[model samples]
Target chain A: MRGGAIAILAWATVLLVLFIGNWIWDAKPVNAATAAFAAVVTYATGVALWLARREALRPGPPAPRSEPESVPQSSLAAVLIGLSVGTILFGLAWANFLVYFGAGILVLSLGRLVLELRSERATRRRLLGEEEPR
Target chain B: MSVATAPRARLARRGGWPEALTSTDHKQIGLNLGACSLFFFLLGGVFALILRTQLAQSNMQVLSDNSYNEIFTMHGSTMIYLFVTPMAVAMATYLVPLQIGAVRLSAPRLSLAGFWTWLAGGLVMESSWLTADGAGRTGWSSYVPMSNSTNTPGVGQDLWVIGVILVALGLTAMSICVTVTVARRRAPGMALLRMPVFTWTALLSVLMIVAAFPMLILAMTLLFIDRTGAGHIYTGFAGAIDYQDLFWFFGHPVVYVMFFPYLGGAAEAVAVNAHKRWFGYTAFVVSIMMFSALSMAVWSHHMYTTGGVTNQYFAFTSTLLLVPAGIEYFDMIGTLIGGAIVLRASMLFALTFFLQFLVGGLSGVFVASPVLDYHAYGTYIVVAHFHYTLFAGSIFGFFAAAYHWFPKLTGALLREGLGKLQLAVMVIGTNLTFFPMFFLGNDGMPRRVSRYPTHPEWGTLNLLETIGAGIIALGVLIFLINVIVSLRRRIVAGDDPWLGHTLEWATTSPPPPLNFEAPLPPVRSYAPLLDLREQQLDRERRLEGAPA
Candidate 1:
């Protein structure tokens, strides 16, 4: 995974260099904007990757973790959040009331998301407690 | 800590339609996305059939010019925005985690949310047909001033703008999640270069999406504003050029976004059936990175004929693409050389994918030149080039993936007989449908017109294309029948049916809720399973040599 980050960074660097060339050669505003956006995204992602793990900057293989991980099965809040976003956007083009309706639903879904996260954390803690040495 | 003391025995509910709809499981989200994509594919295919019918004979009254324009626009939009691009994300969402030996997707909820957002966007786009003015009638690119409210005034055009914005948003979100999952979830010792070929391609694709999709979202938003009379955002020649610049930035890279994953799938199928690791793995990776970069840089080549963009720079970048593309062909041939090869349905499709895409790529070289593009732009030659790449190239690669991964997704093998028949039909149909357009294009037939003057050879060629379109439809029907038949009377495929190299094959067919139930094998190289096989064979040979 760390290696993947470095690879992306390397690719990003190449794109950034090419972007500079594109800028100097023909200074089209749109071209400069696109190049700038791509460069910033790549650079920001590289920084994020480095922050996530400094080793991403100099990677070979990922370090293994021995701990058991708990994975959730489903989330209703997620589904609602998705539907609400679509509804809000669709409403913007189609009807006004739907936009408000979607926003309300979105708020409720976010609240539900919090609850779901809390439940997941509780389950994880209990499982961890059971696995601890007596 | 207080929350930890609360009820921890509560489990997420399971088993029902609601569960199916709301499930955050990456596999479910992927399958859902795929199902929707297939539905859109059929709808888009119907649109194409109608279009071909209209074009079968000169000045046919099958559809009015207005209706014809709408259908063609919808056809291109449905296929590009709904089917191919989302399908790429679908594969990534499903396979990336399993390939990397992760139990769940990173940000699974976000992925689920993205799926619905995208699905809703597809529905809204289609819903434009119900409008009083009809659907978005501009070509899929929807060039401004023409697409401006003054020119194409309608609720439908507004819907189209909003639909594209939502689609971009959804796909972008999902792609980011896939990228993060690949970046964070790889199993220990699975170095980046040692990752499976498919994962590497998927990673590159999602990264390209991350870089490019924002431009699309911004384009659609501004287009919406331009349409709604908020401001005369795109006014004159400069405005049109600016629109093209923005549109093509997303537009060109989106082509590769649609290509790379299926290319990965085909490459994997070829390598597995050839009984070898992919040849030139490091070179292949570097080539794809260059390919993606060059693709981004080459966006203005699409705008070269407009004379707004730097023709030489774009041409250079576009022509340079041949380098990476040529290396890919070389690597594929190298993998097939001196190897025990099997002509399975998957392998056949994969091989054909390469052979057919070459036609598209070579034709693309013709248009990359400024002089040639002036002749080819807005003609059927351009149409033929893209259809070859997208349909003949990507769709075939997609089927190779379907044949390769179907057994893993469902615990049954697709019927080999039906698979081969479908491939044969599609190959014949696809060429018949698109190959003639090259001649028509060269001979000076303009595109996006509902009618043409009754020229002698033109009618005959168009008739052939129409017939070919029907054959393509028949091929798709056969594939559907094959899938249904395979599922009903199942031949149970156990884990690792193809002796697959990736971690996904290490799990059970139709993997369990958390993907893998057993501990994963040691991550030795890119082809970990193949590594295990070689180690066992070496051990057996060593034992036989020892004195008993």
Candidate 2:
């Protein structure tokens, strides 16, 4: 839910700013359309992530001990990148302009951020002793 | 503490050559890294000589652009993938397990795989020139449009891509293993605070490796697809700026991978040689974390003149890098303040690192500005600056680690007096070789060109640089001799040589399968061994005070 809210806020911001940008610069039809479709896809993905974020890393204090937990950052990055790129190039290629750009940016931003946040929690746990939770 | 509980109680006293080579041991891993890094060091040094020989005369027709490309590429690959990373990785692999007082590296089998993969990767990357693409003239970062499929047509680029991705994977696997081992396998009393500085740096390096490398592999995969017609990676079919985004994302962190461990090694050496605690311990830790974060943000600095995102924002972040860089230097200085300096080979390297890396960092501050980058971007000055910072600064620090720990790894002492002499020559030589490139860059001499129009002024500086290069070569030769003669002699160093400040030195010089019998000390400060030494010294002083 928090992830969805964050994505929505970011998409609305990208859309509003770009709409005003297009209004000011008189952006080409393709670019304007790109901005709109991008926004919608961003929202959709955000909802999906919010629904599924539970299956990802459980938000908690980092590792339960001082020993290093081997967080598989690489495997996660590879899979997310493959999916995001695949979505942009194929699935979203012919989608509305807003869908393509919005989905791409959303996945790039939210997806990476969420993974990073999970890793951040894990790293913090490793770095700071989980002697107690705040 | 009894002999029964010792690590060697489980293994043999000695193993033969074939047995050692096939051994799934951390000790073997260390030896493998050391030997291979040394060999690549010599190979890179030879390439440097070829480059210097060509540059010895400008417009001389001695080497073509393609030739220069191959030479510099091999030189760079050798230094980055082979020399610097391997040496530090070796130091960490050899020392971290020992420092943590573990039975063995967490994944010794994966470690062997990493070594073999690294060896293969280096060979493949170096041999890319012999392929139809004639090696990547796009340089090490291989930034796009030029590195893109449209301009650079060749299997060589594809080979370069494959080689580097493999190497990155190898490093990632090794570092992840190290992280797991350090986390789960420490001796009973060892705490996070008690970990050695080298181990700490290794952990940070491992984290950066796991996080940063997938981007490179992905970027390379895209490029590979573009070449094979699977997908448009760098070309505009997919997007134009994508390559730059991904490359710098990984490339910038790659720079940290090159220096951070050496920086860690230097920190460890300086603290012990000065016989004082690392100053501002908590600040150093914070700076390490900050440096890692900033490393991610500052990737855009490489693209400053390209006009993609916010150049000003990147410049600000780039300039902010100085804070952590400064804090690290200050901490080293703090260790030296009011402390008796031992001035060992390691200390010499650390001092040089402080001075030279500051120059690199400070110079970068000037370059970080968009205005300055417009004038100086892509110039030899940029080359000189990085060499000073990374090669002179970090590479020198790595040499220090090698010399400092060689004794412990091999159960022998290096010729310390010779080590100091070679270290000084290396310092002077490195400065002479790279410092003037700043002026050349300011004067607008660009990088990647084979020849220059000789003016008496430029000629003098070039000659001086050549001389410096020769001096550096001499220093390297001296290092080779030091390793060879000492290891052959095996002069008994015992454990705890130099009154070392980490748990690694607590074990025998050439430790057995396990590092230590007891758990590690509580790591609140930088130097746990110093803590142990002080505690022991205090006990002696107290016992003498008591009725004896």
Candidate with the greatest DockQ versus the true structure: 1
Q: Candidate 2 clash total?
A: 10
Writing each residue's lDDT as its tens digit, candidate 2 over A36-107 gives 443444344345435533222232212333544442212233233323332333222123563476466546
Q: Write the per-residue lDDT of candidate 2 for residues B256-309, one digit (tens) a residue.
A: 877888888888788878877778876776677667656755666787776655
Residue B263 C-alpha lDDT in model 2: 86
Q: Give DockQ: model 2.
A: 0.03
Query: What's each prediction's clash count?
Result: 0, 10
Which residue pairs of candidate 1 clash? none
Q: Write the per-residue lDDT of candidate 1 for residues B345-422, one digit (tens) a residue.
A: 999999999999999999999999999999999899999999999999999999999999998987778888898999
Isolated chain B TM-score per model: 0.97, 0.93
Against the true structure, candidate 2 reaches a TM-score of 0.78
CAPRI rating of model 1? medium
